[model samples]
Target: ILAALSFFATGSTQTNLGDNFVLGLSQAMTSRSIKEVTDSMTEHLASRHIRFPNTANEINRIKEGFFLKHRIRGVVGCIDCTHVPILAPAEADEDHPPIVYYNRKGYYSLNVQLVNLLVNMKILAANSQSPSSVHDSAIWAASIIRTNVERTFRKGNNIWLMGALLHICRNAQPGTPEARYTLRHSQTRNVIEKCNGLLKMRFRCLSKQLLYHPIRVGKIIYAAVVLHNLAIDFNLNDLNDEEPLIIDNDENVPNIHNNHDVLNEGSRVRANFIRRYF
Candidate 1:
């Protein structure tokens, strides 16, 4: 069942899975059954695996590793948001309009965020079900992982999470401290970008609009992340033989809300990091 779930979650089509089913047990699995098993496996793997470093010592190790490998100081993790295309709800009411799923890219999707503490590009934590229309920063503000990040900092830990330029910077002039910081930040943070790219590449299902309901679609996305982590842990690096399929629309630009502190904190952190390191 785990093998079958992996096969399907790793971008195999239902028809192919059914055709290649392994005899007796294979006879029992319909498209629906495949989804159920995959979702269950996702729940199991996510609960059992996907560990994020919690202690200050653990976080400090990650920070030191980033500084040593990438010369980016104070960064313990790289964070980024990706969109998972999904079909609009079949039945929409005033409370659940189709527009709820229509993102700025003019397509329906779920704005999923992932954080990577490991350099192998495995996700340590994810927020996978945010509405596509919501800004990336807004999703971060509401996420449990963000709460952890804040707590880690408030403890005088001084750990930072590296994010893309747009999310962290606004309009600093060229040669400015903010500009220099953004350059180094984006370079080190490319791990999340590659992680997201390879995720969509390995699970081609993410490169297209899923036919399932949004809720089930989110489950499938989570399953893919879990499987990706397992592949890394088990040393299955051969999965990237083919070139990754590029999703046409990139991540949404943050629609800055009235939450002024989010932006302020981003600027403050970048400035401090630059003055201290760069």
Candidate 2:
């Protein structure tokens, strides 16, 4: 079963599994069987491996690490979205325009958000099933992790999430506290970019366009993340040895108007951080 999963998670097909050496031992296993085995393994291991920090100590460790290493006070994790390309699903209406899966990049994809621990590259949580058309800030606003962070972390134990800005204000003077803070935050939070790169590079399936059902493709993503976490936890250097891939953010993209209250709160929090720490 492990072999079956590794083969598929490595971006190889079930047909390749059947044609390769392992299953050919007694009799060539059918592609259907190979798929079944891998699917089962992915689900079981994902349940066991992927997890969020539950206790206060665990959460504190993450916060402390971010503050000490990244120099980002109040940050527990860095959040960002990446597109996983996929073929448009069948059984769709041909007459209507494709709006659900079509992203701004002119392709069908799933916008997967990953939240990784800054101290360690371990993936603490992820939301991988969102349609590609959704905006990154939209995904963050809807995340369950956002609610949990609010509920658990109190006023004194403030935990802020870091993400790239879609647009920067032209009025802010260069080398000002606000501008400097933004620059430092972007540089420190870039570890998530490395985390995403290592995951895709290690599991070639993520780097290639997936030719599977969107639902199943989500599972593959989760499974790949689980494997990436395990590799990091186990001190495996092979996956991390590769240089980080250059990920492009939506620079110069105009910000969408959102709830006034939410925007005010975010601005206030950032202002407090700059005043207190930056």
Candidate 3:
């Protein structure tokens, strides 16, 4: 069963898996079994592995890890979105038109939001419910993790996740605080990039166009994320011979609303952060 799962995850089709010497079953049977096993494993494993810190101790441990490793304080995790390619849906309803899945990259995909601990490379949350047409910022705004963090802040917890910094001044003097902050911020955020790359590299199916329905593809993604955490827990060797292909939607610029109050607050926070840390 494990071998079959690995084969299935590595992009082998049901027909191919069924034709294998080990399986030797019909394609229909293989497909049915795969779905059953995937759903079962995801349900059991996701509950155990794929989740954010809920308690004060757990949250502080993650923040300490970030501060120790990256010199970034109060960072519990890093958040980013990655595109998972899927076959175009054959039918569409009014709520979900066909074009909704067609991303700016000219392919059908699901925009999956992943938040992870950078020090240990453990996925804290995997949200695969958004269509590719959804902007990353919109997804971030609606994310449960974001809401939880906000609620925690209101309670004086003051923990947060690192996200993309828009419009860093690249031409700042090399030794200036702005340049120093940019350098450190980019270095710290690179963990998310490596995390996404490692995920696709390990689960080859994610790199390929998933041939399942969008919903099923989402399940596969979740299952893969669970397996990824397991692999990390077991200290499995990484597959780094080849770089994973990460398809990002360059056109999906985050929509920043024209709210002067919010803008001023953000600028104030950033300046203070730079002055204190950089």
Top of the candidates by lDDT:
3
The better candidate by lDDT, 1 or 3, is 3
* TM-score for each model: 0.84, 0.83, 0.89
| Candidate 3 TM-score over all chains jointly | 0.89
Q: Which 10-residue span in candidate 1 carries the lowest summed lDDT?
A: 21-30
Give the per-residue lDDT digits (tens) of candidate 3, residues 126-242: 888789988877898888888898888788886867766333546779899999878877786666788887788778788789888888889988988988898899998766556
Candidate 3 has an lDDT of 0.79
Name the regions of candidate 3 deviating beyond 4 angstroms: 92-95, 165-169, 238-252, 257-268
Using TM-score as the measure, which candidate wins?
A: 3
What would the per-residue lDDT of candidate 2 be over residues 1-278, giving only the tens digit for each residue? 54445554566665655566755622245445545654765667776776777677777887788878877676777777788888787756553234778877788888888887767777878888877877777787798888888887664467777766322233667878778786777686557677776677777778777877777778778877887888887888764445656453523121455567756766786677778776
Q: TM-score rank, highest first?
A: 3, 1, 2
Model 3 steric clash pairs: none
CA displacement after TM-score superposition, residue 86 of candidate 3 (Å): 0.2
Error (Å) of candidate 2 at residue 101 is 0.8
Better by TM-score, candidate 2 or 1: 1
Model 2 scores a TM of 0.83
Each model's lDDT comes to: 0.72, 0.69, 0.79
